[model samples]
Target: MTAVFAAPAGPTASRRDTSPSAVPRAREFRHTTDRDEAIDVITEVYVPHNLVLPTCAVDMTLAWTPLRHLVLGYLSYGAESYLIAPKLETFYHVNLTIRGRTGSQRGAEEVETGNDVGLVFLPSEPATVHWSEDCMQLAMKIDKDGLEAELARLLNRQVTVPLRFDLALELKKPKVSSFVRALQHLRSELDEPDGIVASPLGVAQLEDTVITSLLLGQPSNYYDELHSSAGSALPRTIAPVVDLMESEPDNPRSLGAYASVAGLSVRALQDTFRRTLEVTPMEYLRGVQFDRVRADLLASDPETTTVTQVMHRWGFTHAGRFSTNYRKRFKELPSETLRCH
Candidate 1:
């Protein structure tokens, strides 16, 4: 019932670690026996409970990796704590419990997450989370613009409405299972010395992969439309347009121009595409362009051909967004593709 889209605000979570010297190379913070310090290091917006240690001193660990449009973090604290945020107005966070348990409430929905469960929080909603003393969580913060762009690409349309999601994720489902596995694998890579995730290519690929997985794996308002075959069964009379999309993907022609080439009224062409391919005419065009970009990346010499040059050639205006969509479709970074070839 609540909307998910939110305007950008100042940073919501604190990236600073409590013990600044423990892990200097990677963003890590460790602190003991200080609740205020913990809350300050966790996020600036939340109200923290259990200021006085219930039994033992506060033991906490926070480590994160910064990417172009996302942040991945591992967090753990040794005492029960309650965090309440009036509103999450900056980004979306997906929390995967690695150990112990977390109980979260948003609106009328409540969910408890453990090792196999995942929880989602949207920016426009208020949330209350209770973490057990032994809880360790992997937190993923996805940039608002980056995620909305991904949703737009997946739906092949302008996102005029907020993309709302179910509060709890069914991690047992096949798609969600695969997503968790990938997340674990990425986390492992990042923790390793000289891991691939340390490279620009790996970061780009993983950022997109995590966002796409969350979008597809979780139940959302647009889920049915994304998986439905309602429009893909259209008449086959529009094959000519498909051919043009494949043949001249970078023709720099507008949708209207493509309709003219197809010898159909603009509205008719749009309808034809929806009915036949289950995607808008422009969606197909963009797919073709993505395919061409992948092909060029595969054929390119990594040393001589940079990702920017190739992306610019294909009319990909924003590097962060382009990488997200590319990784969504290809499951690998453009640079990785080039490296393999």
Candidate 2:
């Protein structure tokens, strides 16, 4: 079975989506018989992988559509086959077998996907997939930073680690069912020439919808953190201290300095900040500092300035944590912002 879109033909290039939407026009094709060509084509759309020759003849078809940082595609290897792929490294992959069946192996873990089950492959793991002769899968490729940015937005804090999702998505669960429907809806809309997908804002919002659904519905390392509520709003008494921090975000101050200004004991100030803001005083301070860093990155020219110079000027001396917090706060790297400036 084939899933060809009623659109222009191309190898990897398709007509640009008419409305300047995040979704580009669909790229649909049945590729070369040479295994190497098949590999090259898939690699162009996705990442590199080793395609093990099948016992029978090879017939591969891929109908792909890219929406900004995510790609939604239907893939079929016209024969029973196996593919060994290295660690996806910088992104995530999800596969829903709509027809026949598929099996995935990662480390000692092995799982089969079908109508009632789906698979999510995280970035850190190497994987192998076994596709049945008649298998057809709707595979999703999501950029890691973009997905993590959404996660950071939801958590109201930076993502400290790569998201970890259990390999199998239990389709029977209500949340999972809803998420699958979201994917199916987007897939259907892709075929509509003037659907919501044709609207620039509509496509971006839909992309956010799918990303947020996956982050929330499909459980991950941050699942519990997402569900937990934050502390109550800040009290008026602490307004002046917050104002001081905002006025001088680049200024590095100890907890005692903050406490002295607030006229509270160090421990009392710490407890008050946590009870009101759900963060330590220093964490809140870091958030303020990060905002300033973003402002400076946006204001400076990349050719004349460096992320390190800007970061250190704002007292963000710890390189690793600065990068993580930067991405979490703004959803892109400091360097990414610098380049755009």
Candidate 3:
């Protein structure tokens, strides 16, 4: 024989107040300060919580002046109100939950935000946030111009897209996951004392590559008419041709000669150029030469460097054309850049 215990009666049984019942109570840590030094210390401690959700606490500060990128992290007690004011910085933001279940209330909408959830916010936009106990989140601030330029390159058009996430949507797509991982890696490297000094060029390249990948994954609806229209697909062997061009910017091979080396006809090579890069073979070569010239100018020892010496080194047989195009691509003249530095 077994005795039966009655379920908790009326009020408790009928109630739908899950915040208290479903979530365990936890203490919230808040860091509010007007001091820059204190804020920096807090940011250093809190920014790493992006790796996992429901963190114990969150803190962050921006030491990089002009704030090219800003990251924020927050941990909150379950079922508490939080507010964030608008700032003058114009940047895109990505918010991610690393721990504990959480939700955000925006304007007239209240949505459940969790470990797998992420949201993007635009510059100068203000919003309030609330979270349940044990909730942790990472917020990244993206440079506005940098973001726009990246997206434009990917879609090949200008765009002004929205910043909210749909509940039904899976925000942690493969591309998104890769981006988050890359960001964490970059942040870690940047934090190292001698990291920047050791590999500044590599760091810059990685940053550019990550930004390009993210821009490619953005919503298609954000693309403009120019981007919507399909351009000719690049040739399968185009990579080899591009590699050859980069490796030998000073190669004296004619278009026909290069085409023969790549096992393609002159016309076929021209088509590949037009379709893939939207530039002719000769035009691309000129651009490559210019890049090499610029790099040498910036990095070479000035003691042995001269305008003509650098120009000839990059296969600029014609000073007039090189100077003309250099000015066009980089507004302030090559000499000016080299001289100023």
Top lDDT hit: 2
Alpha-carbon error at 180 in model 2, in Å?
A: 1.2
Off by over 4 Å in 3: 1-61, 65-174, 192-209, 219-240
Candidate 1 — number of clashing residue pairs?
3
Candidate 2 off by > 4 Å: 1-25, 28-30, 228-341
Highest TM-score: give the candidate number: 2
Query: lDDT order of candidates, best first?
Result: 2, 1, 3
Q: Provide the lowest-lDDT 10-residue window in model 2.
A: 11-20
Ordered list by TM-score, greatest first: 2, 1, 3
Q: Which wins on lDDT, candidate 1 or candidate 2? A: 2
- For candidate 3, lDDT tens digit of each residue in 221-320? 4423223445322355665676687689887578888787668999988887776666777777776777678767777666677778989887787877
Q: For each candidate, give its TM-score against the true structure.
A: 0.62, 0.70, 0.47
Q: What TM-score would candidate 3 get against the native?
A: 0.47
For residue 178, model 3's alpha carbon misses the true position, in angstroms, by 3.1
Each candidate: RMSD: 11.0, 7.0, 12.7
